[model samples]
Target: MKTKKLVMIPGPTPVVRSIQEQMGRETAAFGDPDFVRDFTSLLDDLKSLWKTTGEVFVVAGTGTLGMEMAVANSLRAGDRALVVSHGYFGDRFSELCSRRGIEVDVLASEWGRIVPLEQIERALASKNYQAITVTHVDTSTGVCAPVAEIGQLLRRFPDTLYIVDGVCATAAEPEYVDDMGIDILLTGSQKAFGVPPGLAILWAGPKALARRASLGTIPDYYIDFDKWLPIMHEPAKYFATPAVNLVWALKEAVRLIKEEGLENRYARHRRTARAMQAALEALGFRVLAEADHRAVTLSNLIYPSGADDAAFRRLLAEEGVMVAGGLAAYAGRMFRLGHMGNIDAHDLVATLAAIERAAVRSGIPVELGAGLAVLQRELVRAAG
Candidate 1:
């Protein structure tokens, strides 16, 4: 007999049985009419989820591909691009800009800290940038940036197109893309969308599209937003063969999210994250983020002094529970527990129990009842 496995890591989270079955269905040709209808409907649902009236494009690639498309299409060589770096993904956007020969300026906050609105405004005032990039939520540090505030600041620079990497924010929270004044918004199926990696979704406002057209040079053939956007909007046809199975799974996942109501879905994620944080704090673990700026999808917990982070994770794995270790500068200092899509109160309680068991096995001097008691109280509050 095998014990059940629980996946509490951020991306590629646990999938429901119905969605899994949909993925296992026989693959259909990209040009088929039924597949085209499904694909169009998925795009419409994605637009609704993104809260954007702009044209939406779904690329057959990973989240990074979406970021690359935004960078490649929106900026010409030597164009000034400012990236607000708070965690690993923000750093990646800066790197992409640099690789593309764009003049990149990064206003970096310390890991686990949110980027300040004043700092962004100052950057805009001091430089004539062609585009601005910000991560709506940094998965590495579990911090949520002030996108709406930044949107207001960007209004001061009419020439700068606002680009947001919303990989962890989409579906896990409400993103009013049009109202937030985002010119280029990028996300993927892996994180809050609750599907496997390999599909990227981008919603581009008219300004970004016009900028791409003015460039004259053809963008990267595969990642070109111009090419992909038409195909995604037109009756389904292939620029290259798509990942049909992943498309099917994404369609089903979007259906599930809409059925639950977007606000209700966000509330569920918030409740679960709050419960997990309450439990961790009770167990004497310090949270890495400030309460006001912490992301509701995940929590980053600081390890105790003199504790071996790698060994603690190993101990947890032995008990059949898997959690994520920190990324970049945070490696060896903190652990991350994701409470995003499809995770609920029962799942969080089970995770806390597993953590207690792991703590005891590792001789970490934890109180078995403390974490659970805090979690139970939070669940009760959410129910009311």
Candidate 2:
């Protein structure tokens, strides 16, 4: 019998069968009546999902496009923006802004740790920035930023637009845009939305919309929020062709999320992450993220001294589990595992068992049942 493969990577997480079925249906025209209804409802449901009254844009692109849409429309070239970076993905904001001729200033924390709020306060005090970008969860280091506190802190600087990169956060994390004062929250469909890639979803608040209006006719055309605005107002209207089937899939994904209840979904992710993290530690694999500042969506785990990163991952794959390798400087030293979306305890139990088998097969000296034992107890504790 062949072992069933499970994609345990940081992104493009395992999509549930119901959501996957939506993607498999016959493709529909972007302007079809039913599609228009579904698209419009998805926009509305996303607003409710994030507790925002902002304009939501579901474009047919990658998460990077969502990031570009933020800086391209909101700020004119030569404007200054501040990037609060916890890891690589957070640091990417600086590059995105810089490419647009925006003067970018980055406050980057050491890998695996988050930048403190006081430092951000000091940065804001020193500069008159047009916008500030923070990654809610940096995919590379698995560090989760205190976005609510950061958003609360931004209230003092009313003129500065607050942009949050929620590519790896979004539905899995508590991102209440109106309450948190987030002007822009951007994410990709592949992560936590429990859908396949190719959609760039973003919610732009009134302030961000105003900022775009203030700086009308930005240089870029593709990601210009103004161009997307008319289409967003009426989903049946077209600017660029929308991903019709993906939109269908996303609507189904949202429906699943709604049925689960946002609070319960968040709690479930927390429990799952806690369980997996504790199990990894028990297996002698240290998490790259700081214990107090870990991301609930995923874990970036550092290898034990004697284990070969490639061999471990290969063995894990042989055991029918797939995960991603580290990026940038941390490459080959760690592996990333996603535990978000509509995953259950059984999935995680199997993953832990795979890891246990992989570790033992690789001569890592971990007791076969140790990680699984810890995972069960930690999950129960986290839940109770």
Candidate 3:
């Protein structure tokens, strides 16, 4: 019997059967009544997911577009923005700000760890930034930033907008956008949304909109909220051709999330990640992220001294399991395993088993069945 393949990357994660089936259906015309209804429903669902009653935009692009949209519409040239970076994505935010001619002040944290809340507080206390961007989960190192505290801290700087990159943490993490005082929360369809990668979903609170209103001109035309706001207000209107099939699939994905219940879904991801970490540690693989700072969506593991990263990953691939390589400075030194959206304990069991087999093949010692046993035990304990 042939073994089925599994994609365990952090992005473009495993899609549920229902969502995949929705994508295969006949595409709807842009102005079709059914399409408009579904599109409008998706926007509403996105607002609910973000826990914000503000404006939501579903752009036909990737998470990067969502990031840019937050910056482009809210901050004009010469505006000072503070970037809180823990990893590569954080650096990307600063780069995006630079491209727009916005002055950026970066308070970078050590990779694989959360940015210290005190550092953010100090930055805000000293500078009157117009906008502040933080990655809720930095994909590069699986580090979960303390967005809640950061959001609370931003209250002191009431004029500063809080932009959170939730690409990897959105539904996988417990995020209450309005409660946290987030001015903008952005995520992509491929990560925790359990859908395909064409949609950029973002919500902007009233403060962010007011800041945009104050701006003289926004250079980026396609991502300008002003152009898309009317279309969002009237679903029948068109700013640009939307991805109809993706929109349909997104609605189904949101329905599945709703059926699962957001709280339960977040707990499942946490359980899966905890089990994965326990099992990997039992296998002698050191985790790169600290215990408290780890993300429920993904885990970054440092390869053992004797193991060859390439060969180990290749072996896992041969066993029908796929994982992501490291990014930026940690490239080739570690590996990333995604446990978010549509992933379950059984999937992690299979993944850990594959890792055991791969480690043994890579000349790394591993007691037979050790990793799987730990994974099972951890999962059961988590469930209890």
Candidate 4:
């Protein structure tokens, strides 16, 4: 039997078996009654997933398209948007806002640190912004922002819409979209949904819909919420051809999530992340984010002083496990491991074991089983 390479990248994480089986099914006709039912069921389940009473959209695109959809629908030229930037994805929100001619004020934090709530407050107080955008988890730096606190603060600015890029945090993280006063919560299907890449999922609250209705002329036709809203509500209605196969897969994915229970899924992600962190630390690897702000979905680890990123990652590949290299400032200097979506303790143990082997192959002296033993210990403790 051929060995299967373990995929541990952040966005396109491992796909669950059920979802993959659904994806393999023959493509259904767009207007077929059964297909419509399944697709609409997916949209309905999204509200439950995001924990929102608002409208949800599962469009055919990546997470970046979801971010653009939020920006294009909520703000127009001359409108002001305050973006809270902690890393790459946060900066992306600011860029999206700026491209639409929306005046953007960015309150940026150190790469590995979340933006302080007080700093966000001060920035909001400085201007009468129409919307505030934040990244729930910045994948680039493994930093989970203080979203709940920021959501609470948005209450003071009632008219301002709250937008969250949950591409890396949704489903895996504990998020209450309705309770957090989130006007728009957007994520991709690939991350915590345990599905393959190609769908942008989002929820829009009443305020955001009203804002869209108030726009003079929509800028982006494909991403315009107004265009997709009717189709989302009535899957039989056509705006653009929905990704039928991906929607079928999403239905299965959502079903699995419901079976697992959101709280249980969140706890599982946390436990697996803890195990990974413990094992990495045991091997003398330094994680980039501070302990308190580290994201549960992924870990950004700095290459040890004597380790080579290229050589280490190559050896890891030879061991039949795949991880990601860092992005932006940390690129080549660090690596990332994604522990979200269908991942469990055993996966971490295998990854750590591979790393231990890779360390030796890269000429870095590591006590055999140092990291693996720590991971197993942590997993046992977590299971209890």
The C-alpha TM-scores of every prediction are 0.97, 0.98, 0.97, 0.97
Across 79-181, the per-residue lDDT of candidate 1 in tens digits comes to 9999998889899988899988899999988887887888889889998999999988888988898888898888889899999998888888667788888
User: By lDDT, is 1 or 4 better?
Assistant: 4
lDDT score at residue 25, model 2, on the 0-100 scale: 94
Badly placed stretches (over 4 Å) of model 2 are 380-384
Per-residue C-alpha lDDT of model 3 across residues 307-383, encoded as one tens digit per residue: 78899899888887899999888788899998889877667888888888988987878886998998888877876
Worst 10 residues of 4 by lDDT: 342-351
| Candidate 3: 10-residue stretch with minimal lDDT | 211-220
What local lDDT score does residue 52 receive in model 4, on the 0 to 100 scale? 79
Shift of residue 358 alpha carbon in model 4, Å: 0.9
**Candidate RMSDs in order:** 1.3, 1.2, 1.2, 1.2
Which one is best on lDDT? 2
**Candidate models: Cα lDDT each:** 0.84, 0.89, 0.88, 0.88
Model 3 lDDT on a 0 to 1 scale: 0.88
User: Compared with the true structure, what per-residue lDDT tens digits does model 4 show for residues 1-384?
Assistant: 655788987869888787888889998889999999888788877887677777999899999999999999998889999988878889998888887799999888888887788888888888899999999999889999888888999999998999999999998998888899999999998999888999998899988988999995786899988788889889999889999999998888888889999899998888888878988888888889999999999999987787788999999988878999989878888989888988766677788898899889998778889988888887778768
List where candidate 4 sits over 4 angstroms from the true fold: none
